[model samples]
Target: MRVGGSEYQFTGTQSHPYWFGWESMTTENPSVVLQWKSEGTGEQHQQNYPVILQVGGGLLHIWYISPGEVWNKVGTAPFSARAWHKVELGIFARPDTTGWFQVYVDGQLVADARNARTWDDRGNKPRWGVYDSKIATADQTHWINGLKLGTSRADVD
Candidate 1:
């Protein structure tokens, strides 16, 4: 799916924050599966994981910026093009150090990371989509289905 040209299925406002989906990319190029920004003054982008599927470079990078910018790659695995994969992300509505995040592909725990804070001060939510970052190639496309959000994991699974 085109990122900038299309609207996301869910715009996680304060009222709704949980995000999850099943996606398949035709290209091994880097692309954003999901992203959330703080509603603070700068809209400080809190978290997003861009799936790196390049051969010998398969990694799930959890991007975050608190005191400083950092990309945490908690999992690594080569991704096959056009293969369906699952992803789930949970965040607290309010900013606190007790927030957590996890990643799963093909029902396997690829990356599991936790922290005291999942979001920054102010309300936080999700902008779920296959963001064509064009890091490897311009104008990339991805397929997404079973997109969901809920209070529990089962709700999205």
Candidate 2:
């Protein structure tokens, strides 16, 4: 899914709660599950995504990429394969130190980043699905369902 255009783009101090179910068949390293991408052009294209949620080495990780092209591993959570798992994510996208990101797995708070920078230039839009990495060694399959995005936890939970 691609969340761009005026209707879905977000920036500044905002609270977005997202809920989804994910099931992976391969323990592929750096299999990106979700991303918040900057919509800027030219030089900004070289900058990494504002945020990335991915599975690396059978574990879920949250990566925060700064405007200066720094990759920060903010948090990680346990991931179980071959079964659908509930994921709830909340992001406070801000360019300053007041920003934060939180992740809940199976109704438990697994990972969080507080007082961190979570925004980039020109705002961002979300994308979902399994991306990156080469899983050619085995037949790889990923299932994503019930994707919901809302202003509060109640709306998506």
On lDDT, the leading prediction is 2
Clashing pairs for model 1 are 1-142, 97-116, 97-117, 98-116
lDDT of 1 at 81: 57
RMSD of 2: 3.5
Which consecutive 10 residues in model 1 have the weakest lDDT in total? 47-56
Q: List candidate 1 segments past 4 Å from native.
A: 1-19, 40-56, 130-137
Q: How well does candidate 1 score on lDDT at residue 91?
A: 52
- lDDT value, candidate 1, whole model: 0.52
Task: Tell me the tens digit of each residue's lDDT in model 2 across 1-157.
Answer: 4455546546575555333333334344457878877777767654457688888676888887776778888778777666677777777777677877777877778768777666665666676767776765654556777777776666667
TM-score of each model, in listed order: 0.65, 0.77
Clash pairs for candidate 2: none
Cα error, candidate 1, residue 105 (Å): 1.5
Q: Report lDDT (Cα) of residue 12, candidate 2.
A: 72
